[model samples]
Target: MQNKSIGLFLVILILLSACVPTKNIEELAVVTARGVDITEDNQVETMLNIIRFDPEADSLFTSNTGIGNTIKGAREEAADRTSYNLVEGQINLELYGKEAAEQGIFRFINGLIHDSQVSDTMKLAVSNVSAKEIFNIENPNMPAVGEHLDRLIEIEVKNNSFPPATIQDFTRVKTTIGEDPLLPLIGLVDEKPTIIGMAVFQDDRYVVDISLDEGFLMNLFLNKVENKSVEMTLPLQPFEKYKINTIGIESKSLEGEEFHINFLTTHGKSNTKVESLEQLKFKTDTYIEINLTEMSHPISIKHEKAANLLEKEIEKKLKKQYEELFKKVQEANADVFGFGKLYRSKTKDGKITEEEWREKLPYITVDFNVDVKLMHTGTIQ
Candidate 1:
């Protein structure tokens, strides 16, 4: 009787195992990228760039758009139109339009986070024009539209030219208090995927879109991204004899609100006219001073006098720029520089709460001291 019972149980287990359905990879479509936009009527619009294996075409790109009250509803509507199941596990990029981002993208992005099929490692970006416009960019030099955007963002992040924020990072910053989020700015110019700047968000809404230069400065101050190139020009004593050179710099620290950056610069021998060693020294010093100051003025004086004037001008400009950046952050109510974090660190017992920190941040006083050291004068020197 016991042996008969064991046999019956084994048969039942086998039947249950066989009843499980196996997934057919060939019948499912893989999503590579997703774009989110808001229509004029305040409805959510979603576009998915799907990659499917086609025996006739090898790999094909298919776009699907859906409208609904929420992102999940729109996605479901799009999914229903396709014959095969959609696989979002392979998605790599999430692009958001300017209007949609400004309206608060957290609502749409939260849906992706809750979905078990989506990966949190996907990169996030904001489109300067529209996500639809970026999705439509066609370049003969690239493989596909999705691949082009992936490569462009990858290159910028690898070169330290832009800050890389994943969906996970965005979610953390969006929920965290006293901190703002920054997303890469994507531009479609002449139907090409180009990185133009960074979109700054105060909470979940987009506040300011900064140029590449401003973005670089923000990155340097935030100490998030590294590897930067700065150009410096030295004016010779006698008229238009200017020597120009580029330098690679890294941010060392934030002295109060001022940016303290260090660079590996080269000052080389130029074919330009020079009267004396003093003239050369003056021009060289002036160039160094101006570059260190972070000002955009032409060198004015002749001989050694140029060096002094440049130094003073740079010092003044650096102070002014530092003040301006702080004022901008205060007005925007976005602590992109992590001032709140620093304030919390300095508080008594390091136990200040987010609410307490916010109250004290605007009142906190910051001072900056910028120091530039000329390490090398290039191979010629």
Candidate 2:
């Protein structure tokens, strides 16, 4: 009787252990990337690109779609189809459609962050086209769609094509009182991933899209990146062709009641088409002036006519852009530029609330000063 009782106890323990056993690799599907968009009917839509390893078959590409009032609901719907558990840790990129961003991306992304499975390090990007288009792009030259997109991001980072903002970085900016978040805008051009420019958002709502030039300048102002490539075209005497590549821009913000940012840039020779030494020097100065003007426009120049012209141009353009961006933020009531934080830090009380800051931002003044230096003419000079 004692032996039989012991045997029954052992059997019960074995059954409990089996029920709580660890999951095997074969019972999991890895998600490489995900795309989110709002459908025409105003329903939330999501596409998950799942990857799984198989010995007998090639790696599988399984796409699942879900529609719901919220992203969580859609994710729950997607979760029902798989026998194997889906893992979000394997995902590296999250792409959002233009409509979804304009509608409000913060709510959906907040859902993703709160989910236990999602990784915080994943890269976030806004699609110039629809998220559906990005998910559907197929190029034969690339290894896999996910891998291709990942490689493209890597290349862009390496080339300094744009500032790097991971999911966590974006979340920090979004939730912070003063700062707004910016994301790179990606699109498929001829079946290839292209970094078009940048998407600026005030909280969850999309405010405005900026071109590469503007994006680069914004990056410089934000101190997000170091090295960048800039091309400036200058008119050479007697139709002599010349171009200069400006690199290594250093910027600093002034400490005062009004916001002022000063930038100093140095140019190096990528190409110069002048013959004599004097002509080379003249062309270099010309290139600097033109490029500086291109960067900033409209200032009164009484002295140092050539250099002053450039300064005025840059100052004018930058002021205009700053005003435009500030207006957009004020209208949206989003503090994407971190002006609130600046005000708080500058204030003696250090207790400016969001509402108070918003009211004061429109009245705030910003000044920009640009200085350019000609580092080298090139190998020929």
Candidate 3:
């Protein structure tokens, strides 16, 4: 009787195994990139670029749009006409239209966070125009739209022109009281998808756009990205020369409200010919002073006794830029530099509220003391 029971159990187990559901790769539509926007009728609009695996083709992708009262509805509508079931597991990037981002993207963000299939590693950005427009851009150099964007962002991250961000990074930054989030701002330039600026967020909503030049400076201050090579071109005067040089920026400290940087320890090779270390320093100093003043930012710096007037002036320019950035943040009520973290460190609770920071921001005055270290001064070989 025991032998009969064992055999019966084995038969039942084999029968039950066939009941488990299975999905083959061909039955699922893998989304490569997703875009969110607000329609003219004020409905939620969703766009997806789907990847098609065709063995003979160089490119494999098609895009479609869906609209509904809510994101879930729109997504379902988009999948209804497709032969395969929609899948979000392969998404590499998420884009938001300016209108959608400005209106507050917390809902969309929360939806993604709650979804089990969608990953947090996917890159997120703000589109300068409609997300649909960016998705529709055509370029022959890329294998597909999705691959083109993937390579584009990868290059920017390597160059430090844009910092790499994942959905997980966005969540942490926005939830923190003293720090805000920044996303890459992309726009179509000459019909090509180009990185134009950074989208600065106050809390969960996009508030401002930082230009490419300003964004580079901001990254240098935060030391947020690794740059393989950083090039700065300035028209040097007072010594009558123009110089294009690469700069090595190392953020010295986590200064509260204002950025404090040390350039003295950082130096890079330049293509411009210079007589000596002194001549290079002189050229860089003049360029810094002229550019900072032209931007209407005044600066002050503390220097070593051995530092010359030119060195001090160059440091002052960095200070000026730092102050200008702080002033802009205060004006926008966004703490992109994690200043709130610094403030909370002093408090007993080690906590900060976004509203409280906004209230206290206007009264905060931060002064920067800058210095520079000149190294690797020579014309690029």
TM-score per prediction, in order, is 0.71, 0.69, 0.75
TM-score of 3: 0.75
Q: For model 2, how does the per-residue alpha-carbon lDDT over 1-381 read when each residue is reduced to its tens digit? A: 999999999999988898886866677777788889999998899888887664454646666767788876876788798766777777888888989989888888888788877888788888888888887766556434555666677666655555566788888887776577888888777777777878888776777776666565555555434345554332222111111223464422222222122233443211212223212110111112222222222222223554444445444555465557546555666655565665555557777666665666555444333334433223322
List lDDT for all candidates, in order.
Answer: 0.64, 0.62, 0.66
Model 1 superposed RMSD (Cα)? 12.2
How would you order the candidates by lDDT, starting with the best?
3, 1, 2
lDDT of 1 by residue, 182-273 (tens): 88888866667788888888778888877776665555454433334554332323222222223465523222322222332222111112
Give the TM-score comparing model 1 with the true structure, all chains together: 0.71
* Model 1 Cα shift for residue 119 (angstroms): 1.5
Cα RMSD, each candidate: 12.2, 13.3, 11.8
Position 40, candidate 3: lDDT? 81
The residue ranges of model 2 lying beyond 4 angstroms of the native Cα positions read 1-21, 40-42, 142-146, 234-336
Model 3 whole-model lDDT (C-alpha atoms): 0.66
